[model samples]
Target: MSKSKPTPPPATPTPREAVSNAKLEELDQNREDSHGQFLTTNQGVRINDDHNSLKAGERGPTLLEDFIFREKMTHFDHERIPERIVHARGVAAHGYFEAYDNNASLTRAAFLQPGVKTPVFARFSTVAGSRGSTDLARDTRGFSVKFYTEEGVYDLVGNNMPVFHIQDAAKFPDLVHAVKPEPHNEIPQATAAHDTFWDFISVTPEAMHIIMWLMSDRALPRSLRMMEGFGVHTFRLIDAAGKSRFVKFHWKPLLGVHGVAWEEAQQVSGKDPDFHRRDLWNSIEMGAYPEWELGVQVVEEEDEFKFDFDLLDPTKLIPEDLVPVQPLGKMVLNRNVDNYFAETEQVAFHPGHVVPGIDFSNDPLLQGRLFSYTDTQLKRLGGPNFHEIPINRSLCPMHNGQRDGHMRQAINKGQTSYSPNLLNDNFPKQAKQAEGGFVSHPERIEAHKVRARSKSFVDHYSQARLFWNSQTEVEQMHMVKALRFEIGHVLQESIRSRMLILLSQVSEDLAARVAEGLGLAVPSAEGVQINLNVGADTDPAPYQSGPAKADTGRDSALSMAVTAKANAGKESIKTRHVAILATDGADLEAIADLMKALMDQGAQTAIVATHLGSIKGENGQQMLVNGTFQSTASVLYDAVYVAGGAASVAKLKQDADAVRFVNEAYRHCKPIAASAAGIELLKAAAYPGATDILDAEGVVTSDDAQVGELAKKFMAAMAQHRFWDRELKAMPA
Candidate 1:
């Protein structure tokens, strides 16, 4: 008799092996690298001439009988899919999130266990733009992350701004349509600076709070890695004992929050429309991984009604002063996508995608998103089986009684697909709560459903005033300039007048500053209609929001300057791009010394010369040129450094592009440094204290100091990122 085969030992997966690579392994089955392969049709038939389609005698019209041509043309015609109505311009990356410690007391999520690493896919995009729009547009950015956990996929779909323009999802379409280019002309692509948007904002007072953010520097991020992200809606975190606590999600970047000036952003758009996308991709490729800490503000269920603002309101934020964010874990994005369309474009995210420990609150906007996301994926991805797409599939085992639909990828082998079937002996049964099944929190609900909102959501201007009050003087001035630039584009004078009325409700000082720019007076609220969102027959008096006092007068957490100050101790020049302006005969010691100092601190440097290729140093040493003045601009870098040499300074002083570079960097409030003869070049440019500079003037230069000492002072200034104090003395580039 043949010896019976010994039963193989049970296969076991480590904690990291189970969750970190399951999704990637599944996707690997479909991944294909076209290199070293013959070109073939969809059916694996080798092709001859993919460039030219089958035609009659090479010049006549294509023949209908050509099957290969028909197949190729058919596929090409349908290659394009419907872009998202919002967030059409996006970039994504692959990463892993590692928990700091086990917190089963707070959440039973397996991914949140101590030292557990879960793979994640994150996408960042600008709203109000098509797939072809510029990445530097002044708009809200979508910051959505998908965690491939052991239990299931949990999506945290959020935005760079903590608040939204509307309180309810029902009004989302209207808001998008208004912010989009006008239907008649389709002008002003990828921006909200038009008559229709301001007209809609003048009526929707609930949008005032977010409108303030949209008009601030937060709307113009310097890079994708330097901005903060917020979940924007209140969610619930249920413990093992079934107790639920209110939670708000936040993503604080390792790099402190930073933004470009309005004019600098415009220049970046003109020079490189894909500025943010290219920066993210190049950084990851160069091993400079971007990182952010995952934090959550947790509040007890009993304290929900304690805050002056409703926790369910989407247009408000719970100030960190009241409930400080607790650090939970950290996320590091270290990989770029191999194929943009297969992964980044096809990935689907939904606010309703939650594991056992995480749940949702009764936020109107959140509730609306639950239904809207599924419907959108259905229409955009071809059917109900969008989850079967490799990038969107859950890492856990998914099984149900559901049958095949369009684009279904799963195959059930059993005789029965129903739960109570005897043919298959009732296989693939459901799990109990103790067995890792999700059980919704049993919070009692006894009230009847209504079409109206609670009175708690009406205090909209209070948070708006709080945000306006929290900004520093320079930040406030920038906001005023941004408002002037946006509102000045509006052709309707009445829309401008209405915006002034709304601004007055937030702060009279804000309104007056904006009015001064537009050459208009602050409109009176007594005669203006502040509640145009009401129905034709409904009374508008109750919907009109009056100026209310802020719960926390002015939280420092709302100010980027305050955040930068707090992060000063931990700040470094890591991943910062610096421009070293030089030409032939530049001082070799000064260039090598500063470059080495910057590289030692994890900073990146590019030598910008009069031309590409190599430039000769004063000591006959050769240095490679990364870019020329014509190819790279001041807006593309974080700081400017002038390398010292007699010949280099003379050439730079004569080159108009070099002088313009220094002038623009000064105008944008970027750190500028020079050494020895480099100071002569700075004098030729237009900047304050360039003739007789001090270390404190943000223009780091010295006549008698050692090169090492100058490098130290320059790096210290670079750590500050930007010197906003010089903004007031800025001149035209």
Candidate 2:
């Protein structure tokens, strides 16, 4: 009864409280309810569709009038401060691009003309990792080059992988958010092996192709100098006559495509978090410049729809087997940054930064990037004057009326800030198309305003199957191991089971193998909602996927093994690191001759002993030790050589670190060379085939008389990159 009396109608808010209550109610109306409510803009305007940006048509270029996309992308681009939302961790070098020949028919880009040496600032980065993250993370590597061309600055922002995770740009934010660390816990930094990432992949069927790449050895590059780069989106090459051809850009490393083992990558991450960065810096310091041949896969406009896949789909790639890559030029990264923060950290790359000839396709992803990149630079580099930064400044003259912002570097002179003003007589006027000015290809587009994906981008698993079929058995096994490790880390049984179903579409063998590792059965695809982007009221039948299409079954260029064979030659071993295990009383004559022979072949040699500093040779001569057994691991070098001397061999046999070093080198399938008493050390370390060391696949053994032959065989073995056959018998180091 007392409680009933006290429960008089709730007292009305006081005047001040009422006013604050009114404001709270106002904010409550603005707050979005994500449960059953429709998607809306930040301004609370209901969105008809949020899956695709407004385009001229289903397959047409994205229209600039799309305010929804602009606002959404503008928010995504500024989500992080100071560092980039993607590709935050990076390393850079000063270099130059040299054209092979003048072929104006393909493109009129001035930098592509023969004999022109255009200065370029090339930056390499790992996506999905912070600036402080380890460089060896198994993720997509960013390969962006800012070409300071005579016309203007052209940034070829691409990745080591030829394809992307999503087909449209509208889902870019979603893709990034899922791959990033979970919002609630922020665990598992610099990796995609988590429930959130797998959850997104399970629902997004279009990501099948990129998921294959991510779970391959390509995700763990052996060195920055050895990985290939690709412009993921299909672009256009416009000639002077305005002829447009669909083209895919490529950067084939001169050192050839190579990757470290998943185990090695993990170890390197812990041992040297800056493994790739240090390798790039040291190689440059040693005057061993990294080089890559600029290649392009050109497709005629008329033949765009002839292939089984769509050229405008970013998830699909025009295989080199289908359309051969043509060599256009060479890019050599020769100089290290003078100041990392000033040059490397401040450098901004945008796909929209193109010269006259290079232009964009209607690829939805690229179209979204065109708007996102400039917006990203605005927030990250502080305002709109980022182009004024010395690292990003164009060599060509800038005459736009635009001026003044945070960190403005240029000092403008006249009072005529507006265009067409009589004050300056339109001094900085726009040039005609023929006055070496930029002009877009006059391609006609006809369609109605729409927010939908093209039917052409529907088949998501064909190219993924093609990639699986193209991989060698060894490579496939490695991919299986990678998938096992990644999916195994996913704690959610539902997510893991869903991913297995998705993999079954790619290859039954792949899904089965990965399923076996996870101790889970491959679930049936039936009853599973494969596509989550469909509107609640819309029919999900059209969005659901069917059987994967089969076009080109396999492409050899997709396999690193085939690429290594194609690039095998004398130049293959150039800039390779070789560790020489030596100690006091080592063979002076043999060690000196071996170092000279290896260096002559462009291979760097480092003397690793039980201790640092000079070690006394058998002849009482002193030799400097570049590193110690405790200081360096076999993962730091490409090959190992044990010096021959009774005393040195005995000392190495008794040292646990030295024994482990040789064992690890053997486990990694790297070349090993030993001479006379050094063979005893190999046997003691239990290196594979040590009893028959001379006949081992990657081991070279010799007495003093055959020292020259030993060096020759070792160089050949090193050129092979790795003796993968030895992997079957490898033991954990």
The top-ranked prediction according to TM-score is 2
Off by over 4 Å in 2: 1-38, 46-48, 550-552, 687-695, 704-706
Q: How many residue pairs in model 1 have overlapping backbones?
A: 0
Residues 1-733, candidate 1: write the lDDT tens digits. Answer: 8999997855886677788688888899898888988767789997653323233331122334555545643443233369877888999999999998846778887888788999999999999999999999999999999999999999999999999998766566668879888977988899999999999898889999998899888999988999999999999988888889999999999888998889999999999999999999999999999999998999899999999888988899999988999888999999999999999999999999999999888786776677667777877799889999999999889988887899999987777878887787777777899999999887665453234556777887999999989898888888999899999999999999989988988998999999999999997888665644344444566557867584438888888877876776678889889999999989977788889999999899999999999999988999999999999999999999998899988999999999999888877878888888888887778655532433335678877425798788777877777777566555522
Root-mean-square deviation per candidate: 18.9, 5.7
- CA lDDT, every model vs. true structure: 0.84, 0.88
lDDT of 2 by residue, 240-357 (tens): 7888999999999988888888888888888899999999999999999999999899999999899988899899998888899999899999999999999999998999999998
Error of 2 at 505 (Å): 0.6
| Worst 10 contiguous positions by lDDT, candidate 1 | 52-61
